[model samples]
Target: MSIRLTPLGRMVVPVLVLVGLIGLNGWLSATMGRGPWLDVDKVFHLAIGIVVSWVFYYLLRQKHDAVPHYGFFGAGMMLGASGWFPLVSQGLLFSALPDWDITLFGIGSHRNPAFHSALIPFFLVIGLLHYRGMRDFAIGLSVGVCSHLLVDLCQSASSHPDWYRPNFYPIVRGMYGPFAVLWMLGNALIAAGLAYGAAGRQPALVRMEREGFE
Candidate 1:
């Protein structure tokens, strides 16, 4: 059965979906009794975030005045490179003989509690900038990022495995492959959305303009 949702309703649906995904990940981590499961949970969480962003954009495009904001995409790319690229490329900085195992001040400290704390602002800022003058984008990204942080906190409280420690750490090594998948999915969806916006011939935002929430 097809039931139509109001603009706000449409927006809230996706946000709720993202929340449920994050919560599920945390719960799964708790169930697994380790952090490796948490990484798997996060991969799903990131995928949900990508989907929510897509839906939010689809809804926002419905208005006549709703212009595709190329700036947000540009900003997202820059934020990824400047803030996230370094962390992802940590392996590249060291020799192949042995992985770096230093503290936050040195190698092998990438998953330190201090580093996680520092990541909050970075992710939040990127989320906010992803919105880039659009309420839906801002809301979606903010919720997604906050949910992620909560998941992290939950995992931490569970005393799960960390990235730096091996014997004590429960997480699977080199799980970044999953993150790569999520990141690639997000980028692909964003590119499609931008293309749709630019096409301008067939608008993707199918809602009525009179609703005032394009």
Candidate 2:
């Protein structure tokens, strides 16, 4: 016999597990400080973000009275973009929006404000989410961003080579200072601009129907 969880339970149990994994990693990092055991090999944890995506998807699906959950229709544009049509185009890149600094400009730093800091984009998430038809799209886009952070957090917690800074700096990089600026703008603007465009798009057939082309 297998134990099954309810929808809410499904969401809650995994979150608790993720938190515990993070805490365990923290405790190990504090005691070990990148100890010799990992000196000969590297460890990268990518599973956490995939797990957390469920929570993100769940929260994004909640029915808000005013905006309502747009379901598949609201998120159709992004799903297609991230899906097999082109198979992971811009939507996948949005997951790494913060890395634009190094990838595009060749600037590498411990922490960059442009993309790492959440001061501005935090609010942009709320603003974009409130738009009439953007709820699911915002959720899809934000899951990518949040998963980006979760991957960093996992790296920092484990003291992996990719993120050797202290947990505070690597996890949040809260006070770091951005094309350095554009990273932050990139984070928000990419999501907002994409969502805005996707939201306004009407299929050509629909437009033709309205204009009597068909």
Candidate 3:
């Protein structure tokens, strides 16, 4: 039998799943007596990934004129976005894979130009071109990585207070103080706008409400 959801359900369910995963992570961290599984920077990345993935799903569904399996698609996007843990001989590294460069090179600084560079995502998307039928997954992962870097840049700026043009590295000194906060707020606003637009354009959303997925 096929499963389907109403338009509202399509949107609500994925959000619920995101919330559930975050809650589970928090609970696990508390029970395991561990530091937060993800630091605040990483938590920002996770939130960006979930929001971007959900918006992208609606956009793709609208563009393709296809009724995607919303639940499955949403879950896949979330998984791809947040799947950064890598096992080493010592233990599992909970940070994003790109962050390994800092550890590998023994960079004591939390913000590394190489790892947190904004250019990295552009290259990642270009590299993903070799893999067909995986664009959505790649996009989700790239968004997550990029957002992580952006958050790190903000945090670094916040901590340093005097750093300017810290994001692009050697090319430009990053802005600090109010600038970082504005940058973050701008990103949040863009995401919210895209989500709203996608919701408006989803042709199949209401259909799901009536007929459900088949």
Candidate No. with top lDDT: 3
After superposing candidate 1 on the true structure, give the runs of residues whose Cα lies further than 4 Å from its correct spot. 33-38, 64-214
Ten residues in a row with the worst lDDT in model 1?
94-103
Best by TM-score: 3
TM-scores for the candidates? 0.34, 0.42, 0.48
**In angstroms, how far off is 86's CA in candidate 3?**
4.8
Query: Which structure is stronger by TM-score: 1 or 3?
Result: 3
Give the higher-TM-score candidate: 1 or 2.
2
TM-score of 1: 0.34
TM-score for predicted model 2 compared with the true structure: 0.42
Can you write out model 3's per-residue Cα lDDT over 73-170, one digit (the tens) per residue?
34333433333442221212555644655556654543344444434444544554333234333444444554454445544554565555444232
**Model-by-model lDDT, in order?**
0.40, 0.43, 0.46
Lowest lDDT block of 10, candidate 2: 80-89
